[model samples]
Target: MGLFPISVTVVEPGRARTGFRKTAAMRLGSDVGPHGGTPIGGLRAYLANPAAEPPG
Candidate 1:
């Protein structure tokens, strides 16, 4: 088994417009998983931005 490195980033609009509340945005690293990494909570982030390249 190998261990890979992953990162998570969170972005927020910090403002409301058009009578709508702005929600926070989140971003994750490209390399986010091991050979069989199973990120339970991270599923959303991973889905938001799937990795296009393999870890070096």
Candidate 2:
């Protein structure tokens, strides 16, 4: 039997003075409730566990 290890690296750019907030605001609109947008934390967690089985 053999074992293999994997390493991952992520490079997120530093926050700059941009119109990102305005863009998100326009896209999200006034809907400030649950399920209004994608779950970023969950997505990152899933990405972290690359060996996990795919969701059914």
Candidate 3:
């Protein structure tokens, strides 16, 4: 048995600056508690142009 078109690559990410944690807290109807993460916007860049070459 073989899986077609299956590729997995590991990525070393820097400090995560997403507000995912904060958003989850709000979903529970709780006050923001010492949130300290910035929006890295890395995904946004890729979404803008999937075929474009990555910036150096």
How many clashes in each candidate? 0, 0, 1
lDDT of 1: 0.40
Which RMSD values do the candidates have, in order?
A: 19.6, 14.4, 13.1
Backbone clashes (count) for model 3: 1
Which stretches in model 2 have alpha-carbon errors above 4 Å? 1-13, 32-56
- Candidates' lDDT values, in order? 0.40, 0.50, 0.44
Q: Which one is best on lDDT?
A: 2
| Candidate 3 segments whose C-alpha is farther than 4 A from its true place | 1-9, 31-56
In candidate 3, the residue pairs with backbone N, CA or C atoms under 3 Å apart (3 or more residues apart, or in different chains) clash, namely 17-38
User: What TM-score does model 1 achieve against the real structure?
Assistant: 0.24
lDDT of 1 by residue, 1-56 (tens): 34867677999854333311112113433345563255533554534443522233
Q: Estimate each model's TM-score.
A: 0.24, 0.32, 0.28
